[model samples]
Target: MITLNNKKPVNIYDPAYDKLFENLQGNILKGHGRNFTSHIFLRFEENKKDKVKKWIASFANEITSCKKQIKENLAFKRDRTSGDTFIGFYISALGYSFLENFNSSEKETDFFGSMKDANISDIKPSDWESGFREDIHAMILVADDNLMLLREKEISIRKEMNGKCKIVKIENGNVIRNEDGAGVEHFGYADGISQPLFFSDEIQELETKYKDVKINFSSFFPLSQVLVEDPFLKNEEAFGSYLVFRKLEQDVDGFKAKEEKIASIVGRKTDDEKEEIGAIIVGRFEDGTPHILSHEEGIIDNLSNNFLHKNSSNGKCLFLNHIQATNQRDEASREMIMARRGIPYGIFPGEGREVGLLFMSFQSDIKKQFEATQIQANHYKDLIIGQNLPQKMNLDCFGKKGKEINVENFVKLRGGEYFFAPSIPYLKNV
Candidate 1:
């Protein structure tokens, strides 16, 4: 049995976690590191539960495990030639109800509810895309570095589901990188910089790299933050995680135009000065520089995730900024952090195109982690990505104060769902 302390970080490389890692699915502990992804939403045909179960059991053999993913990641880091495809399978609460014979009382409460009824602030099912309005039983995530290979894999899966299931929607995602090769969202801000670290080696690498800098923030987290016992599997090592997927479309033209307008209103005259306003709103510059540490973009190292909002009360980082509003840099905020493995989708240099992020986050609890953070962000009106209706923001950074500017409707939620990425053992046995 794997022992864990609530306050201590779980060492994923330890021998005690061997069975857990073997049984757990990939892309949960860490990212799959693929450039292209296809989200295949599936709905099994009526009275086809037995066929669906058999197909899933056979397909589970293709899903990557945490142990194999770690090895692949290390091999890529050493020689940079690993180009294998990764796959993940997730079942919604409605999906489970259709397949399993268990009672409602035996089900996980949060996993059984649909995202349409989630009641997240500012999210309305009426505003969602039509594809998400239908009943979605399960999703198959296929990702790869090669576009051709990714497409081939998607076709193979589609062909396999011929009469057993219907494809509800297929959302394709591609990684958009900046000139510096760092991953960025459609809005031009660096994405997925701040994350929870589970492995000891990853934590050690960061500590060693930032040895000179006085690191105050801790990214290390226990496995319990993301993993929960699989209700369908009896194995002691069987575990699963809750996945929240949202297709957030960005209005590039509107956001950039209003960003400049807000900058001008904040009394910024020069181009460099105007850039700081965007930084204040995003809590990071376009080039991923932490605005709390440096006023200029690309001036400081981009991987600096060690700063705290408590120390920035002097107005270096605005209290209403995206990062500060979502994460208050307190002990309570630590529990709200989720493993974000989202990727950008649609046309780049977005000009009236469906381009945005396929926001995917894995956590142990949706209510405590994702929903709570969204509520907190809504309360503070996080200007960049908060879903709440647009409101005036206080421009209290960069030696300026008392200037309130209104910027509205930059990011819109198209559609999404809540899913449980079950253990490989459970899938095989079912």
Candidate 2:
């Protein structure tokens, strides 16, 4: 990760370590959806803090051989093939409470405290599921291509930590890919489109279409871009990062019906047109092509993600679209975006389908990285139609999708937790 005279990596990414300042948990920057994923949240019994620490030491030891997961993860991405299981450990705010050494902040910047503010979203921290609503000690993320293997690992892990800690909830997840192998969420839109490009010794080219901008590893990103070094780490100097977990329940049918109904009034006579209307609201064409750059010639390359919002003239791309609203065009937005590793989960049978996304991400700061985006997505109902005075865009109106539009909330937060996964060396000492 040599700093070039021009501010880009001169040649290639340095070795992963020399490139990434922090020893990141390998799974943080990995691709989405190979096969199976299980998110397990736990709570330690009172007076058993020592035992829980010992259990983590043991769990960390069990996955010692997997520290090279960064290498394996990239290989799988390159081959589009399934790799071995990838594991990561994280601890929640409540988990930090049990630690006598931690000096937890009571400020609104803290995720747990912000959740209680109510201004963050309609949902409150108290509304979360049992373990996540309160004293969640830790989270164990198990990912693999084999569902059976994941299940076995989950069981074995529980057996190992049984009395030391207890399982509060587990959301099983997997990549919902199409026949052609394009990743998508349960809502049928292309997923995993947004990722930051890094100029490193290893990263040679843009990995995804959505990542139109690349920053030198030494410039903005490092261990600092992905993790908090102090307080969260026992050694304050080793590798470890903050994790944000969100259980988003998607109203799949509701969203589709709304889209079709809205598109119908726009005189949409074909499925393509209706889908296009949906794309306008989503700010993309389901194939991960941004509406701001989509054309009859097909998806645009370099301009697909016009980071400058240069083409957003005459309300061409409404501020209401999910991507448009959340993908802020301001230069300051660079810090708001983070690498998202989301997985779709749920059954597909019956009238009342119970499927959604297990949205997870890593960031340098929750407030700046994830929360800022969330705030932008939730608000911004006023649309500045071209040069017109700011006004609300009526959803029922045809062609208003291009106006200042704040799309309705299609996903509800169920439960989640904030955690810090420390370095292997620090964990052993803990």
Candidate 3:
């Protein structure tokens, strides 16, 4: 119900919203980046309920203004560094139950359901390195330019929580920003390219009125598409959003090995030619260039949002191509895509550096947005990708060179959980 328009509701940065803002955490309203990120998952002791509440209250000051988070600190310490790097707090459904009130059995998303139902509990014991298959209560994400600084802050936080909570698992993720094949995922394709535009008038203005490829925001997104309304407060305007955290382990070596085989099958010999073949499968070049009308020649900007498959000829990006397979702009699904906030993760990052994405996304409804996309990516299936093809339910035209592009399950879903980041006001009351 909360919608932003020509009439500004209230600036999200206003001091009056201190309580509400503090309740919301980082990477909810905006995008998050990388350098060095340490993910520490936790499980709280049942006896220390009061202590846990006190610890949550301690974040009151840090969560507001949120100034010194990873991004700001990165700028200040561009040359120097801060021992007190940015910290983000997130909780699983079980953790929320540990809080006072507001834990009345949430079933909004399968993410909050029993772990077994999530199918995450079935991950092989060896893949336990990804963590969280067992019952995980909370997650803390700390990022910094200096690894020492990051570790120091993490150790201090742990020291405070000491006996009250136990560290379930700790994983360190390094950055691969601008290092040759940087900005590219382990699969060697541009990753995190097509994120949804946050629905603000200022942002919408830039995309719609003044731009050449006018975006019909209403057609694509509902007002509350990604906005989280405060269920605790009576005047529940927009408050917080849903966070979907998934640890996707990418098979860099396997993907590369498969790409070469696919290249030969399609007759691409040279490196550049093989790369293009990979992109066709991925839906974009390593630089994030979507290959829709790019082959059509006059259109397809690097930052293009104008291209929709229905407008293109029959089979521009074959029905099963990664990019084409993912694009769902129909009235039912235009708003289903969540805003991606994942960063590439690994100790030593790169094409085959044992890397993967710390896949994260935010949305109003996890079931509608994140789950919808997950369904399509789970398999090429019979999912529709328009190219003026016949309206048959079973997409007969979905393949590469008249043969189905064998989808290599390159990404493994090691672990994940859903959390509702309530508004600061709601948290203050709690």
Candidate 4:
């Protein structure tokens, strides 16, 4: 039994690890797909660079010891929708102090300095502004079984490392922690629903559109903009996408109060039944399933219900729904859909502002998937957006059903930026 820092040995042969070990010839097995739970956000103290690296190395070592187990679990499928056992880790940009100086509207800043020389002919007009501010470093984990077990392992790894890493916050279920209950950012509307899917054909098509241009796929592989000889080689590379990890602190009590008021205005039966009210407003449940499809045709599966007979005329989700607002519901028309591969982070703080999603997604187009979501948020109740389009200026987010519900500044952009998650080979070798 291999172990690291006294942690229990993970079993690769266990049914939970099939996906990871699926192609390992005859020697190994894989894991199953399970819910990713027990998120911990560790913020390192400024000037503790060495300590941070050491802690990360030790934690990585512990995870590496379980490679054999990871390879043998049947639950390791890349796109497992059910209870799959999996573990993931990726360093984010949050540990840096330079990120604090970025202004949301600033055209120039230290963080986005690298992007200035970039030839961005391939990017859409709407996405030009989002290419700034590389803040909020992050790591991700997914597992098949209990969240507590995962949390326990994380704590052990951190403790054994003995570094300056402090538990800045923790949470579960889409940025909202257990403590805050129903109040959080990207909570009820099925956050990360309208992400962009990767297609090689699109890459080639993109090349034709912009000769000698590099298109950055956040969570996928092939980090460079240069096209490879064989496109399939790109597939052989990483998933060919990028992941966005965000740590947003939610205004819990405030959100709950607002939601209650919205429900009452919508004539909801009770406050506890706000999920239903939310579903009506967003057209989808909290778990990424469409309430309209769920009750309309008895479609209960979350994933299937999300895509089946989705309404795209005015957007698959409601105008107020976060995902719809983000993507503008142009998915069905353009065959665009982004897969969200992230979860909530931080334990809901009963008092202070500390809770939100670890928030990551694999998308081909950040603007189509990520930026779209932000625009939708602003459309709903973004203070920044509201401030820009004040009521005195005849600004409004809702129409008929929405006019009754006063959405006053709920979502806020703490900070973020575009990042490139290289493939395994690029990550290790390049």
- What local distance difference test score does each model get? 0.83, 0.63, 0.59, 0.39
Model 2 TM-score on a 0 to 1 scale: 0.82
**Which digits, one per residue and each the tens of the lDDT, describe model 2 over residues 134-251?**
6677888888888888889888898998888878888888777766577788777778666653335334444342355553221224435565543544443365556778888877
**Residue 384 of candidate 1: its Cα lDDT?**
59
Question: For candidate 3, lDDT tens digit of each residue in 305-393?
Answer: 44566666745556456665566555565757777777767754465566677776778776667666656644553221111222222
- Model 4 / residue 190 / CA error / Å: 6.1
Q: Arrange candidates, best lDDT first.
A: 1, 2, 3, 4
Task: TM-score for candidate 4, please give it.
Answer: 0.50
Q: How do all models score by TM-score?
A: 0.94, 0.82, 0.78, 0.50
Worst 10-residue lDDT window for candidate 1 reads 3-12
Question: Which candidate number maximizes lDDT?
Answer: 1
Runs of candidate 1 exceeding 4 Å displacement: 4-13, 102-112, 390-404
Worst lDDT 10-window in candidate 3: 382-391
Model 2: pairs clashing at backbone N, Cα or C within 3 Å: 12-201, 13-200, 13-201, 13-202, 14-201, 320-405, 383-404
Q: What is the C-alpha RMSD of each candidate to the true structure, in Å?
A: 2.0, 5.3, 5.8, 12.7
Per-residue lDDT value at 112 in model 4: 26
Deviation in Å, model 1, residue 104 alpha carbon: 5.3
TM-score-better candidate, 2 vs 4:
2
lDDT score at residue 254, model 2, on the 0-100 scale: 72
